[model samples]
Target chain A: MTRFAFTVEFDGRPFMGWQRQAHGPSVQQAIEDAIASVTSEAVAVHAAGRTDAGVHGIAMRAHADIAKEIAPFRLMEALNARLRPDPVAILACEAVADDWHARFSCTGRSYVYRIVNRRAPLTWENGLAWRVIQPLDAAAMHGAAQVLVGLHDFTTFRSVHCQSASPVKTLDRLSVEREGDRVSIHAAARSFLHHQVRSMVGCLAMVGMGRWSADDLRAALEARDRAALALNAPPDGLYFVRATYPGES
Target chain B: MTRFAFTVEFDGRPFMGWQRQAHGPSVQQAIEDAIASVTSEAVAVHAAGRTDAGVHGIAMRAHADIAKEIAPFRLMEALNARLRPDPVAILACEAVADDWHARFSCTGRSYVYRIVNRRAPLTWENGLAWRVIQPLDAAAMHGAAQVLVGLHDFTTFRSVHCQSASPVKTLDRLSVEREGDRVSIHAAARSFLHHQVRSMVGCLAMVGMGRWSADDLRAALEARDRAALALNAPPDGLYFVRATYPGES
Candidate 1:
């Protein structure tokens, strides 16, 4: 068997999420079905992250093992051709060691949340960004975001439905920036609890709008209670940007 | 009568074009119907440029003459409220001088064409950007674009059905820029003939792909014949970005 690593991009609007579900379609099912059609084998695909519904992916990494001897480029092209009319694409594909797993071999992940800080309702970016009518203080949001960086118990920022065994995780970076009416929040970490990025961004947005002070946010983190969460940003604005792997720049 | 100028944004995918059509929906019809619903008057809306179908607008300037005694903010808010579910928005609205016109008063216009130079098909940006599979030399495209800038009788670039009285128009600027996989072409001029920007971009793309040389582009312009046109780009990647008016910074 040969293992292949694929960098994938998807819109995440129509699917239920990355994981397969009995109720609705998913990105994983789409790819697996496409692979089955091409290789006649029901291969399961594994992704670095199982993004939520309506959350986009810029370069989500995944891996699948196949018994057929196929070139990586040919396999990618065939899968893409079979996945036509779907808002998913294989950006790059390469052979990987049999032991290299997409989920367990990743070292870091990064995400960006987009906010359109304007009164106008979104047109082109309707499902791609969050619209904040009131102006945002990006500088203030950035200053407050620093409090969430480094190792900490992120229970306040995790979803109640999260299945993680522990809430303690090391956040490598969190930054807020503004350009005209667009605000972007970037987060990087070794890993994240379910909905942690969205939850953190929600409170940062509150700080940006002056609804909550930086001290209030710091206090919420200390509380480590789900009820202490100020808000949970919608999935529409979140994007899984990239995943870093060992020995790869 | 009160002349209200509106800065509008829209995703043109669902519309036939910017102009009102007899058999299909148009951005003009949507906004006009919204205004009529708000103020019982069938007002005619005029835009700085009549963008084609599937082309987007960022800050398209438009104006309407209304007899109803309504504040600009109120009219804007009402229009937006009524334009629900449609991919259109009124970004800004204000009273303009009685004689100032959206079309005739416009001194300059600008457009940007987006291209994703990658092998992968687009996901979030599908129908919003043109995907070029081969590599592109943006620097070479920019160098060739300079040949089209300045006063020229661009019969080769104008559409056969273009309604402009004269083919002689000055192109103030044409620039190509690239950031990673994204390439943006910005064009600015006092005005443009129908399909002018798309035609220019098509030839520039050929230059980027090494299919045509800069001298070939210059010769095409000098030919000044409709048959000399190499290609006309699809409207999906084109965006009506801005309109400049007299005395407006």
Candidate 2:
């Protein structure tokens, strides 16, 4: 069987996150269904990361094994045609070694949180971004985010449902910037605990609003208790930007 | 009655167009319904220009006269609350003189057409941008766009349903810009005949694809016959960007 690595992009409004679920439609199921339609085999697609509902994926890395002899470009085209009417697309596909795994072999992950810093209700960006009526001091948020950019116990910022055995993870980058009226937060790490990015962003937004200080953010991180979390940002503004593998740009 | 002018924004995917229709939903109807729900009046709202179905508006200028004495802020808030679940928003609102008309008093209009020059199907930007599979020469398109800037009889680009008194109009600007994979065509003029922007964009795209040349585009324009037009771009990529008025920045 030839293993194919696919770069997937999807709108998270309709799917129940990235993984397959019995209760509702998921991005994984949609891609697997499309692959099945193409190969007639019940193939399971694996993703680099699992996103929450309403979270967008710009270049999510995924893989599936198929015995059918189809070119990567043709497979991408065929999958795109089958995924039609659904807000999902197979951006790129390439043959990979059978040993390559989408999730286990991933080395780094990046995410961005978009905030429309305006009081006016969203129109075209309704579900794509989070609307914040209060003006945000992006500089302050950026300064405060620096404290979370090293190895630490992120238990307070992790999800209650997170399955990671240890909340200790090394965060590579956390920066906030504002352009025009939109504030964006960028985070990168080797691996992120469930809801870690969103939780950190929520506390940083508090800092931006002058409700919490950088000291508070540091104190919360030291607490190591989920109850110490100031807030958990909604899934609407989150986006999976990229997944990097070894020796790849 | 007090005249309140609004800067509206909406995703045109759900609407038939900007104007009220006997059948299908319209942005005008959605705003009107919200206003009636707020003030209990069947008020008539006028827009700077009417867009075709699936054409978006970023800061569309419109106005309505209401007998109720309500602050612009309150009116905007009410309308937003009432227009909820619909992909429309009141970005700005202000009191205008009774003499000001959204359509007649507008001095200039701006439109932008977005083309995603890629083979991958759109995900988050579905219904928001037009995707072109062929590689486009944006610089060539931009060079060719300058020829249509001067005053000319644009009969070749005017729609059959256009009700303008004359086809002769001066195009102040028609510039094509490309940032990465997105090619944007910006057009500005005092007024435009129906389908003028889309038709011009369609022909420009043909020029960009090397199917047509700058000379061909000029020949079609000089022919002054609608039959000579190369193509008509779909409404999906068209956006009513802004409406300029006298004494406005």
Candidate 3:
């Protein structure tokens, strides 16, 4: 048996989440089914992060083991073919060391949240972005986000359903940038709590709208209480952008 | 009655094209229906250009006459509310002179055709780009495209269904640019014969793939016959990007 790692991309509109569920379709179930169709072996696909429903993935890292021998490129092509009509794609695949793990591999993860700040409604990007009708001050949002960078107790920014053992985690990077009517919030860390990025972004948006101040954001973090959270942005604009592993670029 | 000019945008995947069709749904019909729902008066909406099936519009200029008295902003908001569930939006709207015609008063038009030159199948961008599996040398395509710039009798590129009085027209700009796997071909002209941009792009792609030589392209243009046309690109990747007019930036 050999372990294979894959770079997967998917539009999350039709998916319930990244994990397998009995309620509805998930990205993991789709990949697992595709692998079964290709290799005749039911393999469990493990993703680096489990995204929420309606959360898109640009280059989500994942891995699975198979008894059948197949070239990496051929496996990727076959998986993509089998995953057709489901908006999931296997971009690249490579055989990995038997000890390598997609979830436990020591690495980093990055996410991006897209917001279309415009008076006009979205057309082609309807399900892909969050539209904020009020004018936003991106610079203010950026300033407020700086307070969340570095290690801290992020309970106020985490989901109640988070499975993490601790409420405190290191936030390596958090920044907000804007271009015209679109605002993008980029966050990176070794890992993150459930809904952490979306929660932080929601509070920052309030600051951008002149409803909250940077001090208010800092106080919310210090409160370390879930009720202190200002808002938890929807998963529509959230995207699992990238994941890094050892010895890889 | 006042003439209202609109800047429109839409995803072409769900519609037949930009114009009202007898058989299928269209962007024009969607807008006209929305306007009628708002004003309770049936009006004819005209566009700067009529796009083919599966062609998108980024900022297509169009105009219509509304007999009902309403503010331009109110009309735009109402139209958007009525256009819900459709992949169409009005980005901007304003009252214009009665003589300001969308088709006749236009000074220039621009289009961009997107080609994903990669081996991997598209997922999120499935219907938004034309996938070319072959490796494309974009520089070669750009060099070959320059030959078609300026005035020429583009009979080979003109569609048989084109109603233009003359196949002779001036191509203001034709350039090919590449960003990683995405290759965009931008074309501008005072006006274009039907299928001219798609036809030119198809041949340029042939040159890009090393299937046709630059000399062959010149020969095709020189032939001035529809029989010389090499290929007609699918409309899936084509987008009507801009329509320039007097006093508009």
Total clashing pairs for each candidate: 0, 0, 0
Report lDDT (CA) for all predictions.
0.95, 0.95, 0.93
What is the iRMS for every candidate structure?
0.8, 1.1, 1.1
lDDT of 1 at A160: 90
Interface RMSD of 1: 0.8
TM-score of chain A of 2: 0.99
The TM-score values for the models, in the order shown, are 0.99, 0.97, 0.97
Candidate 1 C-alpha lDDT tens digits along B1-249: 999999999998999989999999999999999999999999999999999989999999999999999999999999999998899999999999999999999999999999999988888798899898879999999999999999999999999999999999999999999999999999999999999999999999999999999999999999999898888888999999999998999
The residue pairs in collision within model 1 are none
Name the regions of candidate 3 deviating beyond 4 angstroms.
none
Better of 1 and 3 by lDDT: 1
Residue pairs in collision within model 3: none
Task: Give lDDT tens digits, candidate 3, residues B1-249.
Answer: 999999998899999898899999999999999998999989999999999888999999999999999999999999989999898989899999999999999999999999998776787788889999999999999999999999999999999999999999999999999998899999999999999999999999999999999999999999999999889999989999999999986
**Which is superior by DockQ, 1 or 3?**
1
Ranking of candidates on TM-score, top first: 1, 3, 2
The better-scoring model by TM-score among 1 and 2 is 1
